[model samples]
Target: MSTMGRAGQAPMVVVDGVRKAFHGVTVLDGISFEVAAGDVVAFIGSSGSGKTTLLRCIDLLEPIDAGRIVVAGEAMGWHQQPDGRWVRDSERELARKRQHLSMVAQGFHLFSHMTALENVMEGPLTVKRLPLPRARQLAQELLAKVGLADKAHARPSKLSGGQQQRVAIARALAMGPEVMLFDEPTSALDPELAGEVLATMRQLAAEGHTMLVVTHELAFAREVADVVLMFHEGRIVEQGPPQEIFTRPAHEATRRFLARVTGGVPQPTGSS
Candidate 1:
């Protein structure tokens, strides 16, 4: 995909006409968007609207059939050959490119056996071959950033669900990714716990991290997103700043979906 933004600054993440499908059913149909550095872009819609699938495509967990995805000017999955033809990337090459991103799913995907600190440190230690002492130091700092410093020694089973997810976020941060992809990061948490996770995310956004979040939490999208995308039938039906999209949606599907989930208008009154 082509990069965007003012004069010299290229967009951090670019998805141009990307498409994905499963068994003849299209999940993402020629969806395109660009996220500038430090921008928070939220994908919101009803269930099965392809919100999460779009996140998967950006992270390269699901390959796109057509179009391109780029993060920090690095192309994913495919590369140019000497003859000018494009070819699918090798497993090793794909793995290397995927390292530029950090993905946090709705589910906490931590190693059950490792403590919170160890779980966070695993990536830097193994993937980057960082020294153990340096990795542990960074891991502790990230755990503190996520408000899980006190739970560093606790394993996944020992911590509450919210704390586990926080650890997952910390683990992702450990790798120092250029773009963070979150797919319903708080979907599995209760309201009280979800607030804790959202608070951490808000802090990250304020600190200038570029992020792509797929969420059903209208309040978070309204407050934290620089842009809101309404997905329908595998395409972005409408998108704009949160104010325009939430208060005066331009698309019928956007209006209907917002009305149904939000019970009317999706306005945030400072509560998550």
Candidate 2:
């Protein structure tokens, strides 16, 4: 493994020849992709197709057995030393490189004891070591951005599922991340509540945030994604602009998966 900043013209996030496995089962095989700044890319596939695993690898949440992950042009991995011993980079180095990325998971992972305001402020005040006053100010602004300003003082338990997920989004924003990753961010919510979370995400997309999301929401992917990746088994079988991938998929596996989940041709209608 090696670590270095991306050269000029490099993508914000790049995965090259990445492969991962658990026990003897492979989850991702020779996966590769690049996401430029402000791009909205969505990963769609059937369950167990490794969509979530790919997202996790990008964030270093799950270490890959082989491959290179570069974020904001910084490549991350263990480095070989001159003494014939492999030396891993310090955690502090990795932390510094990851400062500009944030992730929102399917399950809203909020601190139960903290109010919505505090939850959003924690990342800045703690990890970033920002001043309390400054953190609070930013937190409030982010909560407002997510349409949760009125629920700032409410604890996670007091908020609805949709409200909680919104707070999670706010918390991720507090880090001022350049790239945001969402792994099925709305999968846990009911239809009505899921709309609220998706609305917040749509707003982010409109504001030109670079985002990569793994989701089963085909309509949402079609509406918000600039590029759509169809993962089958353990690799990306097909990828292209949403219109092409959704309507003129080039792979049999992709067409079959889409047909099973979407029930025939996908209409050009936007997701509600």
Candidate 3:
């Protein structure tokens, strides 16, 4: 795949021909996509479609077996040194590049022992290396941002699933990422609780935060995504603005998948 950087555009995140596998099975097959500054893109697909794998590849949690990933304008790939050490090309460069990105996963992954406030502060204190007092203050502010100020002292076990997920989001924001990747952030919550998390996401969208979300929440995607991508069998079968793809999908696989997901027949085009 060819790589080019456009002038007069802020570098966000790029995945080019990224391929990943586990054991003998290929999960992501030469996937390529770009997320622009302040754009909210949603990935929608049935199970085993590699949506989650693509998310992991972007975050470097799962290394791609082939292809390149560039985030915030820095390229990344492996290099072998003369001493036989397999080194990551531009490790320092990647570190600096990653400061612009943050990720939230399906599981809340909160610290069991720490209060919600401490969980939010941990990233700033460890990653940003801010002083303890400053981190605590910033954590409180972020918790309030997520509407969890009153629950600051609550532990993960004490908070509802939605509240815990909000704290997880607050933790991600503490790292000061320019773009956030959410992997099914509301999947584990009940419907009402999930609405709470979605509301927080909507607020972030209104603030113009660049975000890419992997989710099965079709309603949320229809409501908030600027662009929606439909994945099937390790490839993107369809993508477009939410209205076009959801209301007038051009691909049969997309229509079938949507039918299964929404539990209704795909609506005929131009139907009222």
Candidate 4:
């Protein structure tokens, strides 16, 4: 795919003919897509459909076997040399590139010993080398943004699951990423608790943060996503706007998947 978007602007994220496998089993088969800045793209699929793996690959947590990924115009994980050979990017180079993007996985993964504020501040303070005062200020602002101002002093053990995930979102935001990746951010919570985290994510979407979400929350995907990708057996069998993909899916695989996940409840074209 061309690095330049249709309007000649560089796309925020690009995955071109990407393929990934584990041992001898294919996990992602020639996946390709582009995410424009500020767009919310949702990846929907059943378990083991390569959704989470794709997010991990984009974050460079896992390496792709083939194809390329470009984020904010910089190649991720690996780079081609003048000799026409592909080489893994140096650790320092990958680290530098990683600062441009952040991934919020299903697990909160917060520091058990730290307060919410401290957990959010850890990245800016350590990785970005921000001053203590500035880092604290940023963390506080983020906590408040995620509706956790009062929970700032609370440790992970003291906060609810939803609150912890919100803190994780805040921590991801603290890095000032160009793109945010969420791997089923609400999966671990009960519906009521998941609603809280989903609300924060909706707020982020409203604020125009570019996001790539792999979620089972069809409601969120239909309402919030600018584009929906339906993954089947490691490939995107169907992709389109929420209206097309949810209400009138073009592929039989998509229709069946939606039927099973949505429990045959008709999907509305827009948010409830």
Global lDDT scores for all candidate models: 0.88, 0.86, 0.85, 0.91
Worst 10 residues of 2 by lDDT: 1-10
Backbone clashes (count) for model 2: 2
Clashes of each: 0, 2, 0, 0
The top-ranked prediction according to lDDT is: 4
Candidate 3 off by > 4 Å: 1-7, 77-97, 265-272
Sorted by TM-score (best first), the order is 4, 1, 2, 3
- CA RMSD of each candidate after superposition: 2.2, 3.7, 3.5, 1.9
Let me know the TM-score candidate 2 reaches against the reference structure: 0.91
RMSD to the native, candidate 4? 1.9
Candidate 2 wrongly placed segments (more than 4 Å): 1-8, 79-86, 265-272
- Per the 3 Å backbone cut-off, how many clashing residue pairs does candidate 1 have? 0
Give the better candidate number (1 or 3) by TM-score.
1
Off by over 4 Å in 4: 1-6, 80-85, 269-272
| Tens-place lDDT digits, model 4, residues 1-272 | 33224475678999999999999899999999888898899999899999999999999999999999999988999878999997899998898999989999999898999999999999999999999999999999999999999999999999999999999999999999999999999999999999999999999999999999999999899889988888999998888888878878888988888889989887766455
Pitting candidate 1 against candidate 2, the one with the higher lDDT is 1
- Tens digit of per-residue lDDT, candidate 2, span 1-272: 11221345557788888999999899999898888778889999899989899888777677888888888767665555798775555788667766768999999999999999999999999999999999999999999999989999999999999999999999998999989999999999999999999999999999989999998888889889988888999999988778888878799998898888877755554333
